[model samples]
Target: MQKLLEGLIKFREIDFEEHKELFGQLSKEQNPHTLFIGCSDSRLIPNLITQTLPGELFVVRNIANIVPPYHESEEYLSTTSSIEYAVNVLEIENIVVCGHSNCGGCKSLYASDEVLNEIPHTKKWLELAYEAKTKVLAEVSVEEVDKREWMTEQVNIVEQLKNLLTYPFIREKVSQGTLTIGGWYYLIETGEVFIYNKENGLFELAN
Candidate 1:
């Protein structure tokens, strides 16, 4: 608590003072450039990774960085609604779905029922990412822990990108070349990111 308080004071005294005008302008409205959908991992800082400032990236974070396929029944859809607003309302140009290394959410896809049952809601939420597990299992043996982890996290990014296209608006925009979608795999240990290239269907170093 004390650390957080001091951090807040530091932000106000240094960071805020340096960007006072930008914040004042942003107080009225935010015109973010990209819709960054990333995992709710404490180590995965989207702004820091992207080298973006406060009003630059409109971020939506959830466990595993999952994007549920477009649906319209009657449930509280936070991430979906945020994507809708970023595209339709904000008219944002880019959408990025980022998955990271050593993600607990991604690893949970391989968890035993006994383990997952302890966190029922998380189990349910991870259903959106089960397809990635299926792909990983088919490609690599579960006994190969490192290979399984890499495929699970990166394949999850591909799955979410596919999910994003399920939205009619997103699909139309993508087809018309107005809105672009990207998949990113972040390596927490090495501070590196890989970009998925749909052309060759490979994730290459973002550098």
Candidate 2:
């Protein structure tokens, strides 16, 4: 808590002081270009990883970067509201669902009942990636356990992208070419970002 307070003071004295005009302008309004749906991992900082400035990316983070398929009922309002506002009001041009290596949420999908029962809400939320887990397990060999988890994480990103399209408004914008959707995999150890290539159906280096 003390560290955070000190950082806040430093930010006001240095970072904020340097970007006074930018912060002032952003104080009034924010018009971000992209809606970045990433995992709630402490290591994976979206702004730091993307090198984006304030008011650049409107970020919505949750466990495993999961975006559940759009439901007509207003259930899960927290995630849904952000998606709706970003698309309808903010009119964000791009929606990027980013998954990372060594995601606890992805790993938890394979956890035993004993482990998951303690966190029932988390267990229920992770059900959104069941399709990803099932698909990856069927395709990836059991011998390659590490590879399976990596594949599952990447597969989850693709699954979430498909889920995002389930929203009528998002699909309409995408069809009109006004909005674009993408998936991303972040290698936590190496700090390298890989983007999904729809044509090749694989994640390739973003070079």
Candidate 3:
């Protein structure tokens, strides 16, 4: 808590002062260039990784960076609403769905049913990874737990990208050539970012 307070003080004293003009303009409104959807992990800092400044990237974060399929019947879906607003209102041209390695949410998906049952909401939320889990199970032979985890992490990014397209606004934007959707896997240990290439059906390090 003290560290956070000191950081806040530093932000006001140095960081905020350094970008005073940017902060001043941001006080009026924000027109971000990209909508960054990433995992709600303390280790994964989207702005730091992307090297973006304030008001540049609109962000939506959740466990495992999951983007649920569009559903009108579902009430109080904040993630979906944020996506809609970013595209329709903010007019962000790029939407990035970023997943990271060593994700607990991805690990939980592979846990036994008994363990999963303890966290009912989490179990339901992670159902978005069902197809990814199935694909990993079928394609990847996992003799080691770490290998299985790595596969799951990669597959989850692919799955969420598919889920993002389910939104009508997203589909429309893509069709109009006004928006580009990207799936990213951030390797925490290696400090490397891999982007999914749809044409090749593989993830390559982002240049």
lDDT for every model? 0.95, 0.93, 0.91
Q: If ranked by lDDT, best first, what sequence of candidates would result?
A: 1, 2, 3
Worst ten in a row by lDDT for model 2: 72-81
Give candidate 2 misplaced runs (Cα > 4 Å). 74-76, 141-143
Cα RMSD, model 3: 1.2
The clash numbers for all candidates, in the given order, read 0, 0, 0
Runs of candidate 1 exceeding 4 Å displacement: none
Worst 10 residues of 3 by lDDT: 139-148
| Candidate 3 colliding pairs | none
Reference-based TM-score, model 2: 0.97
Report how far residue 99 has shifted in candidate 3, in Å: 0.6
Tens-place lDDT digits, model 1, residues 35-118: 999999999999999899999999999999999999996889999999999999999999999999999999999899999999
Flag regions of model 3 displaced more than 4 Å: none
Better structure of 2 and 3 per lDDT = 2
**Candidate 1 lDDT (Cα, 0 to 1):** 0.95
- Residue 124, candidate 3: C-alpha displacement in angstroms: 1.5
lDDT per residue as tens, model 2, 12-100: 99999999999999998999999999999999999999999999999999999999788877455778889999999999999999999
lDDT tens per residue, model 3, 78-103? 89999999999999989999999999
